[model samples]
Target: MFADVSGPSFIFWPVGCGDTTTVVVSDTEVVQIDINDKLMADEEGNEHIPIVDELVAKLPQRDGKPYLSCFILTHPDLDHCRGFADLLERVMIGEIWHTPRIFREYEDEKNLSDDAIAFRKEAHRRAERCIEEGGDPGAGDRVRIIGYSELFEPGERYEGFPTNQFYTRPGNAITVLDGADVSDRLHAFIHAPFKDGLADDRNETSLAMRLIIGSEGNTLRGLFLGDLSYPTLMQIFEQTHAHENNSMLEWNVLLSPHHCSKKAMYEDGLLQQDVMDEFADSQLSPGYIVASSNEFPHANSAGDNPPHRKARNRYEEIVNDAFLCTGEVSTPEQVQPIIVSITANGIELDIKDYKLSESAEATLTAAIAKARGNSAPPAYKVGFGAE
Candidate 1:
């Protein structure tokens, strides 16, 4: 279902309160960023989609095995890397992109989830292989370290790793994926986990990137800022401005950072005006903001974690009706992915192809009627016109 896209597309899976985005770069190249596949979703009586299984069924194959060109881990958070081991066992991943945070040992390392540990083991194995092979190391053994730190210097943990060929420092653009040049269609600009921000805080060390798809005037920009808070975001905007690279902040589609946490735009019990201003200035026309979280409540209580109602309200002001929450956008019966197709003309949401089931159509009609303060369903059907 995914590989059939006529051109490039971005597929955001509905993995509640986490992130799992697949970038279909071409018919043969695919890049997946983060994963939150829950095995419990497959248990009897559960209706949640087994996302990894769904992905395996549609991914293009290489030598009779499902193939993924690149797997990017935004951070070592459990939610972000939950299915790395499973994916590794099931799919043939060509390369991996990760921050240096995974290499450092922390006191809380013992508390890490099994999947996070699995990812670290695999990432370390690839890095070691790159060191042994001197450079490139060919596809499956390739690893692109995004961000700089003392750990990568000579005589350090990654001492022999070939930085010249496999490293990408912050504020740089990467045009190559797994050994192929996809500059004509796709390129990603690394934007975060700045040298100073790579501290003990895992959230602060999240890898942020702006992925540009299509060419020149017809390009669609997507900002995937993983879990960064207001201070780091402000730093990014200021640095981009100082370097006259404000274009790096432009975005047509933005995956709302940190699952719609208020921290992304708020600090000290108040909204940071400068950060919000930068977001407003950089947004392209017809912008779309997606929240990869559970459905937001009407209001949030004190100390309540993300998917915050207040944060959702702020994002709604930015994109209005275009603000979508993964938990609420799909049919009531099943969660469907949010697909945005990129073409020579531009980008368009590809939800029109969905043929709503009878129950789904009824649910939509009833919801619309309720919103309109009516007791009966509207005479006209809404949403893709019920087939």
Candidate 2:
């Protein structure tokens, strides 16, 4: 049980691909991330949004006050930033964190991403609406859209948002990670392609972070690396080792990169036997690794080869007990939004009423029990059967 004292509640909503992630650190501090498309009612009384909409709808309303403290748009990708325009109309945003790419002065005559192009158009339209209504265009003092590239550098202090001063740029470039204190509980650290690399204008620039969930001074950790590729992952391994005293290979839970795409593991193609072996041996084990992908037989059906197969092969080679896309965890739609709750006692995940195969459930149960303790079953596993 959580004490009445202020603490954080980690809830990951199911928008798969890209959606909102809410973090409630007690009654006063609430943070909502990347609100995608809004809910729309069809003629026959059908709603268009997914399960995450239901969760957002349940957020308690306050008396005409802003309940949200932060809104982070990791990148300008349509899947990631689609709902930001509409969301600004409903929620009170304290700080807007984004990459300078949103307002970058790119001189290339070639058009940027069509998705980003469309989002920019909508952003302008929304800004016009806000101005017409005599509302604050800047969204008040707290509502500033600052780029991550603006002030983030190794050894530099991120002091703009005093509340979240728990960030540091530990390398020579623009990479952000949790300060010593933040890493102590929610161990979310950015380990990846540095600022110099992000300037190359490649998907490798995708924000790479590791989230460790455990109580202060506890032995539990969970790492989430968002859509990172092999080159980037290798760079992270090197940088983290040079910066911190620990190894990057150490993590309790890992979310597979690029939805388990083989390209993430291989540069040229899967047929390259040398690349395959290197990836196969690089796998980390005795921990929970999740692939947030659809239940398709192949990774990319249209591609010459797929990474899904290579990912599975690599897992089999390294972590024999790792979780693969099978039964419930196999299908993205069937995969439940994972909710990680942490307290002084230990850590637990509330797998929303998801359909879990006996083996998958057993693996998860054992992993949790082994990492935390042998107490009663977690609240999320109440009625779930391992058989």
Candidate 3:
């Protein structure tokens, strides 16, 4: 079962304070959400995995070249879109999904990372082709613009670009990807970048969504909220409930927003219990929350960046022991990507026996001996390398 699963799977790479997820929709179809392929990770002493190579090796091929069915950029942040240009050059991407933030950056003359600039250029090219071809410009030139911005107005850059074919607003559901009908096995409900919040903040304009995958009778739901904060999350919760679309908020797996930043649940130095309550309410039994960040500190200092211990504590309360961190799960000797596979029964982790480092092994041995009145420790299996 570890090596073979009949249904779709989600692979979250350990990129250290970044996000890189691959959704294997099927043997022939796949979608990648964000990327942070650090080239320095390939250095001899670096523990990070060279994700681009790993991804290329696993991706399905078309016309004798690596092919990605769709690539979704949640936002233009460097951590989210880093190495995108390299990926684009090496792989044949069928389509791209993005928000208007990329274009807005150019209008504001904000300095963008090279990858972000490349993405913007590619997105603009596809949008132009979409307009020129009238609709559904076929793979490699197809673009799906999520959320609204003035840039997409009828007489603006997106003029005549067939809004119905290319645009998916917040509160809508998308059943097609790159012109392929995935309604039978996949559905993504748009949930953020609300029309009113498309200001200068890139993080606020992130394309958050609830992705449901599997057969109609049995499915796995994952909520991928980019880097949104408390205010927007509160809005999403209230809006979803008001529209009688609470099902869109349900999830078996949730990628903790903003790499487990406290901002997602904190406002003015206070924990927003309503947000926590909503998450606890929406989670299915045996739920899992994955934080794609570096190993969290025991406690965060004032103004410290994310992977915050306080935020992790709250998420732990929601999922109990099912909360996992990509960084903590990976070892120096082995770069373990968290793999959650869908099976005939449901989703399950592809657990592998992790060899503990010498120091870790010694520490565990001492702990076990102390617990047993200083007796020798017995041999034991470590699941997911958890202590």
Candidate with best lDDT = 3
**lDDT score of residue 219 within candidate 3:** 81
Higher-ranked by lDDT: 1 or 3: 3
lDDT of 1 at 19: 86
The global C-alpha lDDT for each of the candidates, from Candidate 1 onward, is 0.78, 0.44, 0.79
Ranking by TM-score: 3, 1, 2
Candidate 2 Cα misplacement greater than 4 A, ranges: 1-12, 23-52, 60-66, 105-188, 218-220, 247-249, 270-286, 298-307, 316-336, 343-345, 352-387
lDDT of 2 by residue, 263-363 (tens): 55666664434433433443434355555443436444546322366666665555534554322332333444455455565544455454434443444
User: Which run of 10 residues does model 3 get worst, by summed lDDT?
Assistant: 378-387
Better of 2 and 3 by lDDT: 3
Please report, as a residue range, the 10-residue window in candidate 1 with the lowest summed lDDT.
378-387
Model 1 misplacement above 4 A? 39-47, 107-109, 352-387
**What lDDT would candidate 3 get against the real structure?**
0.79
Give the alpha carbon lDDT tens digit for every residue of 1-387 in model 3. 111335688778777788898887877888999997652232122334556666565577989988899999998777888778878988889999998777764543245567777888899899999989999889899999898877666678777887887888999999998788899988999998998887746678889999988777778889999998998988999999999999999998899999999999998899899999999999986589999998889999999988999999999887943898988887556656787777876678763553333433344344444545633433322211011
Predicted candidate 2: what Cα RMSD to the true structure?
A: 12.8
